[model samples]
Target: MSDIDLSEAVWWKSRQSAVNGNCVEVARLPGQKLAVRDSKDRSGPVLIFSGSEWAAFVAGVKGGDFDL
Candidate 1:
């Protein structure tokens, strides 16, 4: 949250990402958190999440919980 420093965060996109540059980048922050941003716009908005939150999201993804 407010305690995490993102200025020096090193963001990286997934190797699985396609070459079309249509993917998001992620950075591991301090205190078991993560920072996510759009790869197409580095200077755009960012989203932060706690460790548990990220885990749940990943689980949902793998379980197809977000599938429509």
Candidate 2:
């Protein structure tokens, strides 16, 4: 993932996110990178992910890979 302008990125919240109004959002940045940040903390730290890695993560989520 290369340098991205988080300031211009449009974040979309997770589908499983609840209505508690405290969920973070994910935005697809340039170079197929995934950017994440807390919705409640726009100025907070941002996490970046590569395209393939992000895709695999999404697939895992759909497959309940993190389910205990």
Candidate 3:
């Protein structure tokens, strides 16, 4: 579990999110990290990733690495 404080974190989801709100929200965190959580489960667990990790994930996404 992370010890980061997110009491004042501002979160946002992609503009392309579905109408049903089944999407994830992301927040910028301290020390170049990021926090991600399910939009439907605001009080649930959060996933944290480092800047490099997030960049790699974004690159992979743009490269269609996760394409079905």
Candidate 4:
């Protein structure tokens, strides 16, 4: 993966996100990849993950895999 020009990236918040303001933004990059960052700090380091990887994480979340 090369450098990503996040400045042009359009981030989308999750639909399931509560109205409590605890939301994250995801940007679609080239080459079937995605960049995720905290909505509170857009300038923070992003956690880049592949589309498949993100899907798996979502599945895990829906399956109660990360329930504390």
Residue-wise C-alpha lDDT for candidate 3, range 1-68, written one tens digit per residue: 45899988999999999989899999999999999999999999999999999999999999999999
lDDT of each: 0.92, 0.84, 0.95, 0.87
Residue 23, candidate 2: C-alpha displacement in angstroms:
1.7
Clashes of 1: 0
Number of backbone clashes in candidate 4: 0
lDDT of 1 by residue, 1-68 (tens): 56666789999998999898999999999878899999999988889999999999999999999999
Off by over 4 Å in 4: 16-20
Q: Provide the lowest-lDDT 10-residue window in model 4.
A: 1-10
Q: Backbone clashes in each candidate structure, one number apiece?
A: 0, 0, 0, 0
List, residue by residue over 1-68, the lDDT tens digit for candidate 2. Answer: 34567778888997788887689789888778888888889888889999999889989989999999
Q: Write the per-residue lDDT of candidate 4 for residues 1-68, one digit (tens) a residue.
A: 44777888999997998787678899999878899988888887898899899999999999999999
Question: On TM-score, who's better, 2 or 3?
Answer: 3
TM-score of each: 0.89, 0.79, 0.94, 0.82
RMSD of each: 1.4, 2.1, 0.9, 1.8
lDDT (Cα, 0-100) at 44 in candidate 4: 79
Better of 3 and 4 by lDDT: 3
